[model samples]
Target: MDITCDFNTLPKNGHYKPLLEKEELKTQLLLNIRSCLSYLFPNGTFHGNEYRIGNLQGSKGKSLRVELTGNKAGLWNDFATGEGGDIIDLWAAAHRKDVKAEFHEVMASIGEWLGYYRQHKVNEAESTISWDYLDENGEAIVKVYRYDTALGKRYLPFDVKKSSYTAPEVRPLYNIPGIIKADKVIIVEGEKCAESLIKQGITATTAMSGANAPIDKTDWSPLKGKHIIIWPDNDEPGKQYAEKVAKKLIDLGVISLATVKIPQDKPIAWDAADCIQEGTNPLEFITNRKSPYHNNNSSNKLKKIDTSIWTNTAPERKWIIKDWLPVGSVTAVYGDGGVGKSLLAQQLMTAAAIGKSWLGIDIEQIKTYGVFCEDDEEELWRRQCTINAFYQLDMQSPAFLDNICLSSRVGENNLLMVFDNKGIGQLTPYFQELLADIELFQPKLVILDTAADLFGGNENDRSHVRQFIQNCCGHIAKTIKGAVLLCAHPSDSGIIRKTGTGGSTAWNNSVRSRWYLSKPDRADASDIDRVLCRKKSNYSASEQNQISFYWQNGAFVECNAHFNSERIVRNNYNKKLDLERGRRHDVILELIASEAYKGKVYTTAQFAKYFEGKLGLGSERSIRERISHLATIGHIKFFKRSPEHELSNTRSKYGYLCVEDMELKISEDQYVFIKPSCYLSATNGVLMPVENPNVWVTHNFIINDNFKLAE
Candidate 1:
């Protein structure tokens, strides 16, 4: 390392003054000089160290004589007022004659030290008359310069007075708002907190240091006659400061002091500056709170309080039809048992997680969280297979399902997840805590499968269920600001599909959208499976045949063909097959005609008998085959029974519709004819309807006595 020293010229203070102790302090000066030499060489003795009085002609102070002896000795000398220039020449001559190099260096060092001491001592002593650098608080720092009698000069040995200085001016200690006119002072411990108060238009100040700063009457006099609020730091020191300041204010006749405690685990702080930066208003934090510390002293104080005061504004609701619920929406999917409710929910969860379509509905990318409260090994296996099929990976491996959370945490949003298998009430805190975790991670979508499993109370009670749903929805919306999909089970009556697992209307009312699904007829083998579009929506419910799909190889697949052989066999004798074959639109028209005539409609078997029995077919299969054919060709009509019909079995009725009910305006030249299977298809055993009847009628048909043949 290299070491070098340079110096700047000294600054001029008020005036220069000489000390009166030049001659009288000669002994003291001599001892101090001897001590400096001794410090340089601990084992050396002073050969000559003396103070001479009035040795200089123009200077008022005396000079010092110094010598050093460690392993060698050095001569001592003092220069007279005019000898500074002469001493240099004398020293050079003396070195040439007898002065050793090491001895000369030592003398030179002593000479520099004496020069610095005299200059600094004189400057410092003279400038101290007023102690102008210190404030009213009496804290001041001063540099010292001693008077130099030799050479009549002041010189610095080392530049110790570099950049160390503090000015005595008052800086605003508290940030006060310009709006507040009250002459009050609120003392705080932190400048940031004081600024926070200032944002509320409150004038407050903080101790430049902490509350421990030594403040006297002068420091405390600003609020002598004004109001004082002591909002201190949270810990013991702040409380102590409050007490101390309060006592002083009391003595000064200013006793209107209020103590406001901001409850916090760490240090309590309140003010405008700190909180305004956090995007909060200080006045709101003050006026918007109901004191948790309120006492029960009076009836007014004990009045009923609404608990929602401290709650933040609820997240805005999102109403989703075909799309994902908006960042804070609560959505529910519900159906009766075996209605694929869980499957549908889980599908949405995985789709959100992977950014895929759910039931062919387009979706934007988002993380999804799903939890299944009811999962058997089979269901789990099925779910895993579905995920694998959808992702087209090895579902057996843990990685495929890893993104899907089966445990409580359920990786962040739009990622597939599930929750506890047991009831919800038992895990309220656990759910709330999970919501907190969601806020931390910020997933895109959250799905809770089967609302019933999550709730522990009586699901039939609409009010209670609504409250629970609202609570869960509120947290999810507020924290995640993301969509929430809830899986639910419909009621036992099956009146509505979206009745949740809790079996309450509240579930459907709270949800934004609802979709229903059910099995359709199979005897009319040409018809597809049905998905009922029951509730309110902007779009039409998918055709029953179009929406019903199967979960195959881990993904939802649209079925090309549906086989309802059981239904076909069970109602083979009834004309229910006509509606199944897609003639229900005409059937409804037929019912209107029949009800208009007699205020009552016949069952499906009656219509089937009317159409086929007129042709004298003994087998019900033959009549059904004909009805199915006619219905498919849009020549005849069919209708399913309404629940109000007095059927022995609760099953809906099916029937043939009259020609008037068909609602057609035919021209005089057009006529419809029924043809045997041989005319339409060789493979089909049933008959079919044809638009032209002239050719078919010429082939065969006998005019009956009861029914006239139109010519």
Candidate 2:
């Protein structure tokens, strides 16, 4: 840390300066001795930390060649007058207080300076708990926490004088020293939570910026492939922060992750600190047995699904260009790198923003947020203007321009991240604020340009794929109640296979809608060779699975083919998509749980037929596997119906309720007819069967044993 030139240091205004403890007084005085000299003598001159001229030696002019450079730095001599003294004597002499007769008084005045340092220490607003944000070696680069006084608790740094505290750089996480050694690392929101959890023998860490710092903004690379659980502050921002971190961590390829979303009933913004303050064990709150997200092949995990809470019908599919762009879902637009992913998305956004339809496809006329990692605002504007000119739309119209919000990272700060002020990985804070901005605008569509930049994860890793899909497409889209258009690259071979670049099959599987834009025979391509084919369309409401659009006049318009899927033999249905079956498995089980609680029963085929194309689930085998997968995951139990209510013995059904829901009374309706199998309820955390005749179970069926929020 470079020290600031202390040419204008100030002396303790005696009786007014707060007194600091001995060590603190020494440190404060040493911090800027030149400042103290300047304060003592309104007539002293300084060059750097040394004296340039002094009135004590009567060398008021810059004639002295004396420098203050001894171990005591206070010892200085003027070559012109050969006068020298310790720093204290110089201070006393400069004040001209008649030090010979009032030596004690002069000394007392200096002592008063030390006492000034103590002022704030005794002030009720000062907190005693000093938290250090340490590096891997346990050396603190910065210390920050809150001060307790009549001013209440205030978040502040250890001292602003140190560059460690005030430099506009992102510091490492608090308690980073222990993160590597701990088998399990729990990431919390603030320093206070980090401290509280550490005291309970739990290893925890958090970076600077509270909820504002994204996980990518810090040195998370240290914890790469480490199993960790993220516990967020019990608030909206905290939860959002957690979601962002979780996604990035997956990108980092962490071994496992489980999020302990503190129960909703707790106070808002409550954190580990609150739990510790209330004498509650913080670690006890972590709910799930840690497992890698998405591919946790754990044999006994039960997920409780409640479709009843979901809207009776999913939201109507919204389109910017009919089937090509669906609202309230994640759509993947992939093409050859530097092809037209960004251009296609931009044209669609411009059309949507201006209430104009693209390729004559009716649009919902909604706003769009375009996050372009590739181009700066100026570049985006240049392209926007070109398109605007081609469309002959008024670019000056605030109604037209304001309908589109463009956030470009270009110029000097193109890669310099303010969110990750230190620039470790600025994604978290960047996206966190970006999403908040989206919420404010509530745009119907958000175009994220290029996963190559947004996702720092290996495009091929399944875990990274799951995390990204769940967060960006799942959580972000749901939060804004809009659609997300993710622009990405396809592998060099993707032109032939029809999937996006490096991203795993999970990326293709998780999104509600997907498209692969490419050209036929790149070596001999003609103007009309480009094809924007729908690779996946779970948003089954889309009108077409594929379309061929010609790039003309700086925008896409109908060419030889449009508004048709059959024309492009290779379409969404034909594309071999490797979608993750786990998510859908949970959905199927949840729907069955909802029906079972209402005393409805169904076999594998029956359940499959009922929910084939609804709830974003698909395929008979995929649906059938939901039963075994739910039982394997432990959300529900697999059981056989008794002879009285016979379903095939080979096929088991889950009608069991989790004890957490705990509604066991045989109201004339709770169980219209008692199946012969006994029910297992997790009472007092012990799985026990009811011997009383009232509650009867036909046979063992999957039950949601781990039914609490994995939040």
Q: Per-residue lDDT for 1-711 in model 1, tens only? A: 111111122336533321212211322323354554344333433234332333322123344233433211233344553332122232333344322444334333334454534333333334322211122343332222333443442311111233222111232233322213456676777545665676566777664444764445124544544556666666778778776765555544342445556666333544335456678664454344463222100112124677766567774444322433444556665566665666666666666555566665666555556666666556766675666577565655443344445433223232211222222122133553565566665566777766655665666544455545655554576466666766666553332111122344445555555544444434443323434333322233433322545555545555332544575456656634433333333233333333423433444455444545342343544545544443333333333332333323324222323322111112332212112212222223233343453222211211221221111
lDDT (10s digit) by residue, model 2, range 272-306: 78878988766544543342223110111234555
Candidate 1 residue 434 Cα shift, in angstroms, is: 2.1
Q: Distance (Å) between predicted and true CA of 294, model 1?
A: 20
Alpha carbon RMSD to native, model 1: 28.5
Which candidate should be chosen as best, given TM-score against the real structure? 2
Off by over 4 Å in 1: 1-283, 287-327, 376-382, 394-403, 408-427, 495-502, 521-534, 538-546, 559-711
Each prediction's TM-score versus the true structure: 0.35, 0.50
Question: What lDDT would candidate 1 get against the real structure?
Answer: 0.43
**Segments in model 2 whose C-alpha atoms lie over 4 Å from true places:** 1-22, 30-35, 46-109, 113-178, 181-329, 337-340, 371-392, 407-442, 451-479, 496-507, 518-526, 541-543, 549-552, 559-711
